[model samples]
Target chain A: MDIATVNALTYEDFVNVLGNVVEKCPLIAAAVWSGRPFLTLTALEAAIREFIDALPESGKEGVLRCHPDLAGRDLQSGTLTRESREEQAGAGMDALNSADASRMARLNQEYKERFGFPFVICARMNDKANILRQLSERCQNERAVERARGIEEVKKICRLRLEALVLTDAANKL
Target chain B: MDIATVNALTYEDFVNVLGNVVEKCPLIAAAVWSGRPFLTLTALEAAIREFIDALPESGKEGVLRCHPDLAGRDLQSGTLTRESREEQAGAGMDALNSADASRMARLNQEYKERFGFPFVICARMNDKANILRQLSERCQNERAVERARGIEEVKKICRLRLEALVLTDAANKL
Candidate 1:
């Protein structure tokens, strides 16, 4: 949790901690492992750069598969782990209300029908209103755009997860 | 380009035309109305829920903005037209090598020193190498977390121009 504590981790330790995150998301693992000679920070960064570049076509579907459908009242029951659900739900259920919940469910169905996947986004940081607005607006995007957007969203989610996982010291060093 | 033509644009057009990707330094923006949305569709998506619940800290920043540092690299020079040299440089420099370029210089320094924007991700259906690599490695971020992840990146850039000025459909819809 502390920067000093995280910084103290050996490169192997660092990799081990990150391994959990990578395992949960293959795109992330691919990005981390892509390219060779992890000699310097810059080189490591280059590997990341390469991964980001390649994500759209190659990694989009893989990342999408990691997400779960966002429907039903039991927000806790979806693909999100308990921690993720708690973090995302926060005090928003009351805010979601009945109409919002129904809309989310309907949109969820339409989204799946069109794109063959649940509507996924990084809800950890957003509030109820913004999430609702985005869901309604994004539903309007053509199936293609929304599909591609879905992959990008997954990458952003991973980026956030990565950010949270990074030690404060390593973060500062960067 | 006509709306129909633009709307018909495939993944490439979506990124090149709608997303306004840069030719060099995929992350750098030459001017206003250039560069990708800060939050990927997926990231924005997740944030949408949080936004609905509480309006995440940077939800406002997710709007969009013009790059100040990209002023000098304008393709046409002097004129600051919507389609001017500066603007073109910001939007069209996606392919430029990041190794040695003033844009990258300003982007890296200003982005890191200012608020730690680890270069936004757009995945405009182009070469996935750069984006994939960035996504993987950027996971190890802290400061870059807020600026680089989710809708924050888009919000930072959106301030430069109004929605009406860039996205025709969004403008009309709004």
Candidate 2:
């Protein structure tokens, strides 16, 4: 909606309105709720970003871990969020053949073994080949480095979600 | 440094050895080559991670465009090898901030003008508050989806560059 409308929203109302932007990380939106009366969407986005950035490393890891793998269990079991499902499909992840899927599974296992978390990437920005390439390449990184990379990917997913919510809300006059 | 001797190479030789795991992505070595052989490291790390599933999107307009604002110039400053710089830094983009970076730059400008890129999340992973959060967030996207998500983040960067000479040379070794 308009800046004035968002700026005036009640904390509960605000959370209900835009909190799913970060997948399971609702606290990010909740934490920034009181910072409302935002002069612009930019100001509001900044507030939310600050809250996430200020979180402890454990918190960040929690956020990264919250994301589903590119083509793992979530896809097979139909547990991925609609946004995630669509993003993965857009990246051509849904098109993997059995052999490629098997390879992907192997890489996924190897990656988790190496990095201690599921492999996460903004699938919306990738093709299946590139995603697999990254899965292989990043598995070789140090844990700390991979953790940072994972969080960074989380940030991208969140940003896209935020844009969709805010603009659609604004356009619809929600 | 043949594959047979790779198991016995000194740390220095190991870096000199399979260093080019990916064709063009050479910095993987400069960054972590010192870790060496890895025969024992993996065993130790696995013992430590019997712990941690993990943890855990955005506004419109401003959010999509947020990340393009970071100091991506560091990408072109030659401070980051095309590969190493892309991952630790963000989306594999160096020319993102440059107006003349490519046709992608043009689209990025048009995107901002139309729906444009949004500014949603903070770019840093763990906990630093930079207004460039969205900029960094977009950078986190895989080079592919990011290409469609915006020019600023392309997943293509993650693929092996496949230098014909190197592959042929390696094939000969095989």
Candidate 3:
């Protein structure tokens, strides 16, 4: 809907509308609820990003863990939120063949084993191959680097998903 | 890189090695390729009642369009395999929100419009949310009664790409 419409939502309504905007991180929306009457999508996104930016390291990891693995079990079992499902599919994670799927599953396992969290990438910016390749390449990085990279990817995901939640017509006026 | 070594691949090598098995499609892997050569995953998945059997028409829609929007700019951008970027991303169709990136752009537009060539479901299964949701919801149709349902989704996307040359892996496996 329009920003005007968004602006008119009650605090609870606003939270309900945007609670899933950032995959499993409703608190982001919850935290941003106090800063309502956002003039533009960017303003709203920035507020949420800022909250995430200031999050404690553990908190940040918690946010990271909130994301399901790319094409991981959640997609098949229907456990993922609507936003997460769309993001992974946009990246074409739904159509893998046997050989490629096995590799991704293994990569997901490895990335989790190494970093203690699932590999997180902005699937919108990537196709399945690229996501797999990056997951492979990133698995070699030091933990700190990968953590930072995951967050960066999360930022990209936020921007993409935020644009989704904010509606393009509303964004066009900006 | 050959099929023989697929099982022995380390997480890194595995990702680099079998990375493109499905290229644009991620579900084929999640559905078929499991940790123990795939049978275990699908069986265990079956036991959970998660196996995608005879997807509802909407579910079929998700399965069919699990491909990229053929002609998505990413193909021309040289970031993805030519076929996949198009089938998954659909470039020239600018209307889709970055969030809608999971659905093939032009194909999605066309499929919704025509219900034709673009909606071919590969018949494999996975539980990815976007795929399942699309599959479940899009499967609802009056198409069987009206042939028109099959043709609309394909026509909307002839220009951005009409390539029909890429060989399916089934041939490669053969």
Candidate 4:
């Protein structure tokens, strides 16, 4: 869909397509829908990013919590929203051997214990090796840094989702 | 799936299948899973109801908030969880005429404005007339009454999901 098509969307159509762009936080899309007729797909994403950044710290944590843990129970259960399952599978999460799966679970748990939110990365941008390494390394960061890190990763994921949903000029990858 | 099969599922698989039985509040299933080896499908539901009943008022309200409106945006956007889509359709929610759809949307907005949560009914159990009537009548309810009323509907929905998942003897409808 082009920016014109995107700008033409009714609130309901826009939310349905981009609601999960931020991973179960359609409220973001709902909140940003009022900022329609975006000059470019970039502006639409910027609006979403602003909405997320404006949330209180607890609200930010809540947003992160909305995300399923990578390779976690939702994946095992076939309960992942279609977008998440595809992203995780793209990163080879679905093919983890037992030992690696157990390791990922442990790291996810420990990270959540320390930071009170899941360790989020743009699964489409990182393969199995990078995701595991980041989880291990980021465990040592202060809560403040980890929180920002998670939010930034959320933006990365958000951009990829937007690009997939909205067409842009060659110079501006939506 | 039978009672024996339910009892045999590992925690992950159990949660995956039943996680959404309570709409988006998988935490309820996660909480109830501690009481394993349910002797009958009834026992499993009883365990779930007990857990829900134990939640404080705010938690109960949160559970209600997790529900999509009866014929609201998620339906328009195709974002309703599969279970919800089916439930609403089962009750003819998807077949609303323009007049009724607008009325339902107006009632939904009014209900939320007044009560801070969507007007909820077990769609599988109530067709359009009954659902609309209940919404109108229930709008006049005290918050406490509506709260309890909402929880009861959730339980009804829960029971249907449970029965659909777990087969039982003729004497015990799961």
Candidate 5:
């Protein structure tokens, strides 16, 4: 959508746009949409602040659920939108060979067995090797510890995505 | 302190233990202290989740402020406890050579100039060199973009610290 069109949206329309994704992850949806109209980029940030503040406690789990698994090869093909899949895996996958892929799969299984969820890490800055190293090390954490760490990683991912969205919207306007 | 001792704390005492640290970063304080009488480690986790959910919109900046500058070594000494310093920087001043020091200073200045605030990264998982590399690369981001990224990093750090605290408290009980 055009920046003007997005900017022209009423608060309800804005909220509705976000609400479409809210069920996929309500806390993030709320965090992305909960505040007043964002006139400037700064105001948009302030809106984000308001939304994060008002998010419900239960919403954190939803945020956690939105992340793709750490192993680039393991995520369900259709689970993430095309952009998200590219963002999470494209760079790292280029560097991974067959051995790395197998190791990642094994680690993924071990991590899920230990934590009851897929291993998640913010892939924006990490390369394939670094991610594999992290996965192997993190799998050693106790269930409780790993769970806490996983949630934190999810929060990081959401914040990055939010920023990207805002920036993209701003660039489109310019 | 023992879990019992922590449990015995009045709200005031709990606040005191956290000290001015929380006051300087109220969102983090809220996240740390929420859902009190934390019995199991999981209970503490629940409290942090509640705190993150309950955070005020105005508190986002405060939370972001709590992070030490990514390349500002002086702030690092003050921002992290001694143990954290060793873990993040690998042996403190002894570990910092002249080349490393200059790189950090340059990166620090460049980052602040570009982003308005000090550069912020969750250093828990990175060593000095890696952090310096990240600082150098991220300093290239435009102000609005980097500000958003910095806030995201701060959120990650806060999440990690909260988990560490809960795990430490749980270990104390055993």
Candidate 6:
């Protein structure tokens, strides 16, 4: 849909379409609806990023916590939200060999223990090998730095989601 | 917390505290935060209901779809969000017999098949037996009727959650 179509949407329709753009945090989309008549897809995205960036540390962690663990149980039981399923599959998370899956599980557990939230990267932007390496490397970053890094990744995921749903090229101009 | 304390929370704090009041649908809490400085707990809950009741049929379904299945894998694996885990346990869902657990699984699957959303009842307001009975009976409801019933159950769940988090007796005045 065009930016006008997106801007014209009622709150419910806007939320229904863009709600899951930020993992399980439909709250962001719901909050952003009040800022409608977004001049372009980039403005819409900036609104989303601003909301996330303005949250307190605890709220930011809550947003990260809403994400499912990479290659975790929800993926196994076929119960992941559609966006997550597609994104995970795109990065070969759905096809991990037994060894890779087990290693992923171990790393994920350790990551959560340290960070109090899931290790989030934009899966569509990276493949499995790179994801594993990043997961391993990021696990050692200072907690505050890692939290900021995770939020940045969330923005990347959000931009891609917005591109797919609304106008594609507008965000690039920003 | 008292009404003043509840009302005084910043949007981030308000959402952090009450975000899961409607199961996984934090969008309701996020949207409700805009209406803050509530006069009383009753008004706070009314705001939540207003946001929900205003949703179109599909949005209502989207709210219901956010619920985890009763005694489903989330419970078995101990991965339920804190609010859901406590609510389910308060009704003794944590201790279902093997036979009952299997029956619940089957019924939940069938209910989803019929309604396109999980069977939802206020588990804190009903024991496992009543939940099962309601699930079985509601499974036969016309799709539209069942959807409404599920939303009412969500409201009941929301109220109980609000009572636990904010003032308790003020909502009874409504």
Candidate 3 C-alpha error for residue A65, in Å: 0.4
Candidate 1 vs 4: which has more TM-score: 4
lDDT of 1 by residue, A40-101 (tens): 44444444434544543323443353355554434545655443565466737434668877
Alpha carbon deviation, residue A141, candidate 3 (Å): 0.9
Question: CA lDDT, every prediction?
Answer: 0.42, 0.51, 0.53, 0.79, 0.52, 0.81
Steric clash pairs (candidate 4): none
Q: What is the TM-score of each candidate against the true structure?
A: 0.39, 0.48, 0.48, 0.57, 0.40, 0.56
lDDT of 5 by residue, B94-162 (tens): 356789878777877766555435667667766676787788898888765775676666556555654
lDDT of 4 by residue, A31-111 (tens): 576566799989988987887676555456656767788999889999998889999999999999998899999999899
lDDT of 4: 0.79
Best by TM-score: 4
In candidate 4 chain A, what residue range of length 10 has the lowest lDDT sum? Answer: A165-174
Candidate 6: segments with Cα more than 4 A from true spot: A168-174, B1-19, B22-159, B162-174
Instruction: Report the lDDT tens digits of candidate 6 across residue range B142-163.
Output: 9999989989999999998998
Cα lDDT tens digits, model 2, A26-127, are: 445654654567777778777866766664454455455556677777788898878888888899777889998999989987886665456888877777
Write model 3 residue lDDT over B61-143, tens digit each, in one string: 32233333333444446665443443443323333446544555543454545543244322122223444345435546556
True lDDT of residue A96, candidate 2? 87
Model 5 misplaced regions, further than 4 Å: A1-8, A11-23, A30-32, A38-59, A72-78, A169-174, B1-174
TM-score of the first chain of model 5 = 0.68
After best superposition, candidate 3 residue B147: deviation in angstroms?
60
RMSD of each: 17.5, 20.1, 16.1, 8.6, 20.5, 13.1
Candidate 3 deviates by what RMSD? 16.1
- Candidate 2's docking class is incorrect
Models ranked on lDDT: 6, 4, 3, 5, 2, 1
RMSD, candidate 4, Å: 8.6
Worst 10 residues of 3 chain B by lDDT: B159-168
Model 4 segments more than 4 A misplaced? A168-174, B1-174
